[model samples]
Target chain A: MSINAYLAVGLGSAMGSVLRYSVSLASMVMLGTHFPWGTLLVNVLGSCLIGWLAATASRAPHGKLAHWQPLLVAGFCGGFTTFSLFSLETLHLAQQGSMGLALLYGIGSLPLCVFSAWMGERLAFSHPPAA
Target chain B: MGHGITSVLLVALGGALGGIGRFAISNAMAHALGKAFPWGTLCVNASGALLAGWLLGVYGVANTQSLWLFAVAGLLGGYTTVSSFSLQTLELWQRGQAIRAALNMVATLLLGIAMTALGWWLAQG
Candidate 1:
């Protein structure tokens, strides 16, 4: 990849990570850390956004929004969503014997995030006809 | 060095390094392991989880806001990803590899957590 590409990914990831931090803190305040609603919210939202961006990017003729694909989708959305913390938090819950909550979070994450992405893709195709 | 700008800059710099490192490692892994399975992302996420757990366990959430922003939120956050994992799983299922997709999902969740706990426990000791 070019230096520009690296810079784009880096900058986008930085912004995304910061947003994630804010969301996590807010979620903790609102929902409590009993469950990781923070990471889940961002993960689901980020997946959906990346899906929308990916679909939009794919439909664009040629490389019309080439730079945008990496900056927004790969860098921003990817950095915004995290699987590691989700896993760790779930483990913490389970290890502490909160098996129900752990299972709920684990089972809920995959389908919800995947469906959100699907919805995003559908929304992208719904309006503003693909180029 | 107030909270607003310094925090943002720290996270940004850490994220940039994390993102770059993730790209390099993933590329290297793909080169070595092939793209049939997403071993690269799996490794990255697992290692990121481990480090994050260790950092939190060792630091203990007192006066490490900047460090937390840089390491946990920025570095590990950028290093690991959920969107790619979800998309890859979807793609695998779409390609008729249902079993592989399921295995990937289960293994990632199980292993990621296991490694994180391991790291936390190690740091505690």
Candidate 2:
């Protein structure tokens, strides 16, 4: 809404993107690109964080934390988790005739991300209500 | 460029630029296309995927960690999104637009992946 909001999103997105890169690089080193574990990890983690923040904000008494939505939800999570590259990677796998792997990846991502977010929301609200 | 503090900074800067670009493009598309469907997000995701594929193909993945950070990780990553997509799909389902919700989810995934492969294929030539 304001210039400040834009700045916050931009800065948060920058940090999130950097973190995504680091995680992906680390995953590649530790595991291997045989399965796109890096993107999966980031996407699920970002979903979980966003869900937690959104749920927490909804239960908060004040709207103060709402202001950070753009920065955390729209910018950070959005930047950290990428649908584009996920799709791209799936396509690559399919093109390589690893149709089984591609199908596994495709079917796996949506449910995993959605469930992660749901878990996050539940986790945040599962605790006793804040006084 | 090697992976170091400078590379991180470069990725950060690229991410900033990409995030701003995504915000602007999505807003502009929403203004033009109306808000019935998330055309803005779809466009962003699809294009970002294509670009990621092409960039990786062009740059190669062996010795270009910095380039990967700046382009694929920072720029394309910032430009694309999954959170918004998930939120929107949930919203649509909640609102009883189950069909559109399914359409959005399926189409974006299918098209995004297809386009990425196309970009990668093109880059080979």
Q: What is the C-alpha lDDT profile of model 1 across A1-131, one tens digit per residue?
A: 67777778888888888888789888888998777889999999998887777777777746566447768866888788887678767877887799999999988897778778877878888978444
Write the residue-wise lDDT of candidate 2 on B49-86 in tens digits: 88877875687554246677677767888889887777
Task: Specify the poorest-scoring 10-residue window by lDDT in model 1 chain B.
Answer: B55-64
Q: List model 2 lDDT by residue over A1-131, tens digit each.
A: 56776787788889988898789879989999788898899989988888777878888846666767778877888788888668767876877799999999987787677677867778888986444
User: Could you tell me how far off, in angstroms, the CA of residue A56 lies in candidate 1 after the best superposition?
Assistant: 2.0
Docking class of 1: medium
**What TM-scores does chain A show, candidate by candidate in order?**
0.92, 0.93
Provide the global lDDT of candidate 1 against the true structure: 0.80
Candidate 1 matches the true fold with a TM-score of: 0.90
lDDT of 2 at B72: 73
TM value for model 2: 0.88
DockQ of 2: 0.63
